[model samples]
Target chain A: VPGDSLSYPEDLCPPDNFNMVSTWIYRSSFPKKKNFSFLKKLGLKSILTLILEDYPDQNMKFLKENNVTLFQFGIAGNKEPFVQIPDDKISAALAVLLDRRNHPILIHCNKGKHRTGCLIGCLRKLQQWSHTSIFDEYRRFSHPKSRSMDQQFIELFDGREAWKVIDPKWI
Target chain B: VPGDSLSYPEDLCPPDNFNMVSTWIYRSSFPKKKNFSFLKKLGLKSILTLILEDYPDQNMKFLKENNVTLFQFGIAGNKEPFVQIPDDKISAALAVLLDRRNHPILIHCNKGKHRTGCLIGCLRKLQQWSHTSIFDEYRRFSHPKSRSMDQQFIELFDGREAWKVIDPKWI
Candidate 1:
């Protein structure tokens, strides 16, 4: 059960089927959300994002109009600059969003599933939430059809001792 | 006819047996002797290199000695950062190897092939060398192990409108 504090974006409507989950997240494992019509519908006017190459142009126009500050960081998985960002950058994203009173941030991948879920999942983990709580938050909102998108990340959690710090919900 | 300035790295073994010329380069391309061992002999007391990933301890000790710098910078084919080195950083490496100029400066990737050759070739182009001389430089040094490699690079040359700007032998 999600606490009253848990919030979901009002615009994340079911796209007639669960398969839509795959369409949004595909290219890379960083937070590169695109197609902001949903954000516009939900009245989200500002955002910050990190994305890989060929980010959606429509989203660029959206970010520009919304006056959001998009910080593009490149990641080549298992390659140079391979070191993941410190927790500080993570905190920074949330701090700006929260200070502005949760201006409806949209963290996403091309599919808006794995990496997006990962970031959100980690936030829940930090807050000591239960697996039920985090999944509930996910189910309550986006209702991802594709569950296996995070297979590698889940495997990493087991291998890297990241589970020790993973939010309780993931356990 | 090869020029008097014809020089190539000794121990010019390609990373693999398949790394011959022509098949991997363009029909218009020429290659000279350059190989991986050239890097080991650079005599850096400290070097951060990723090449050690492929070689076992019996083969390499620079890593254990903490004498290699292996940060990612070059472009990965799939827009990933497999081995990334920014342009400015390579210039830095060039500076370290040369003062007024007498030092062995060798660079290579698998095969002494495409990527390595391309960058070196760019140095020649910068010198405003003629395409005739440039192609001559490549042919004199490498026999094009496979016609396809030569075609690969020659294709790149054929397409470049400003051929002189990217010749690969001047340096």
Candidate 2:
């Protein structure tokens, strides 16, 4: 039914590429106030922010007012070849995400690419997803600008450590 | 960058509404052979089919040859209020889904709506997702024909039993 003919909402900062991961978790780009309102309407409980830089006070204030917790993981430069995402940060963020109470959680970065993509790639690794599938999903977002180091990170992510501590119910 | 202006691929049945849920799992409508090839290209290792009826021999054969496993859960009717999805079946399908070996999996129905939406809804419940977010994702797929029963089922889904048994490493 979702042919190429239908039009989407025109609101700026509308949750970009928003999709559900097992009903509780969501993947999308950064949310503006309007998008935050939309998230509130959707009953979002927490946000896993991957913006390497820039954290607006107003947005943080709005999130607090809305009762939405923010989990910030700032790793600069989505495309700077040397800016590698730290494994411990990813592990820590995922630890917060492990609690079922964090359901309806959103994982996002500035453009919902690069950093977000890498995080998802690692998650896929936890899920035991193949490298090809991981890369395809990454390319779907980053497209012409997808970086190789991020893919390498995902390809080599070892989830055994994360698994030993994370709740098993998520799989 | 992913404004509404960009165009998706031209391949027919190329995983409509296709997106990575956790790097491993993908969500989309049913696929044709061409789509199958596309999926194969992406290294899809398995499929979680939710179509109630109509499993063509060609598709099955193709999957077999391509080495992609198929997990079929046929629930009759998409919008027929009389045709309700069985809870046990959902539990069973989820059981298959729980295995990390099933990563790079695709969950699909004819239109990727109704039944698929219900399953996703229940999964959200497992993740402790809010009804608002669950329904929003459902509507994104079902659009004009989004059914009330499906929404009702999701709103009332009891994930306790399923949660008690499924693996947690997946989240």
Candidate 3:
């Protein structure tokens, strides 16, 4: 029943990434236990969190109870000069995502705006998508406020280096 | 350049109807003159105004200058037992929409909530879409408050009778 395809409840704010290349990969804001019923429909086996803050115990317990794995990756800071996203963590998260066992994964942050956006921006780079398209997708979701630093970071990211570290066969 | 296709500005809330069968049929809230540049991108030939209150002079003047036709169809009141939407006006509006010449049309009320939503609900019925799907679309856009009368109105509408009055070659 948990894995059955059903309409996502309105409260969940379910993932609807415009550039999702696979149904197995999802991007969303931080999900609560109330969202679990609807999220269960995604059949997610892993969660890649980029909170850069304290992880709630309830969420950790929920994931364990649901038999889902947790992969926490956070970048310290809010804006540029303050923001500090390490390449190694992103590569590690990508490695987790690449593992076939972690199919149907969700990536999330506080509001799924900046940090999550950067990770997705890097993923788009790895997929060989154009810069214009990547920035468009990022800005569309993060409208009213898009950080130029995130754009700059994405543009400068060496996805080849990340892939080299992760050694993902799919890419 | 006024009619040329351009990227819709992020500030202007562009039309995003869930049940749009044709790119020509656009639905949105009342637009300010500032929205004209972005709205122009739609290449709209006409606007269907359903505001119960007086239509602003600026909007009318803007429409005239842009060479776009206006079809004002207002329904009185807010909730049930008060709101009175005339059947004939709906017939007329449908007639206007049926004319391919008046395509790339936009339908709007104050917030594009009740009246515009009702018309869309009725259109969904004419298109033979499911009630569940119709309500889902309505509630998604009109979240926090969705009236039952609107749903009832759409459910009871005789599309055949409306079609009989407007009998265009298009479905």
- TM-score for each predicted model, relative to the true structure: 0.29, 0.53, 0.49
| CAPRI rating of model 3 | incorrect
DockQ of 2: 0.06
Number of residue pairs clashing in candidate 3, backbone atoms closer than 3 angstroms, sequence gap of 3 or more or interchain: 0
Fraction of the true interface contacts (Cα pairs closer than 8 Å across chains) found in each model: 0.00, 0.06, 0.00
Best by TM-score: 2
Alpha-carbon interface RMSD for all candidates, in angstroms:
30.5, 15.6, 14.2
Compared with the true structure, what per-residue lDDT tens digits does model 3 show for residues B2-60? 11112222333233321233346877667876567657766779988887677789887
lDDT of 2 at B109: 85
lDDT of each: 0.34, 0.69, 0.67
lDDT of 3 at A17: 27
Model 1 segments more than 4 A misplaced: A1-38, A54-56, A71-88, A135-171, B1-171
Question: Pick by DockQ: which candidate is best?
Answer: 2
Q: Write the per-residue lDDT of candidate 2 for residues A1-171, one digit (tens) a residue.
A: 111111233322336656655457787877766566457655778888987666798788877787888888887754556566677888777766666778778888877778888887777666444566567667766655788877887776666655555665653
State the displacement of the C-alpha of residue A49, model 1, in Å, after optimal TM-score superposition: 2.7
In terms of lDDT, which candidate is stronger, 1 or 3?
3
Could you give candidate 3's per-residue lDDT for residues A96-136 as a string of tens digits? Answer: 77667787788888766777888887876665545775776
Q: DockQ for every model, please.
A: 0.01, 0.06, 0.03
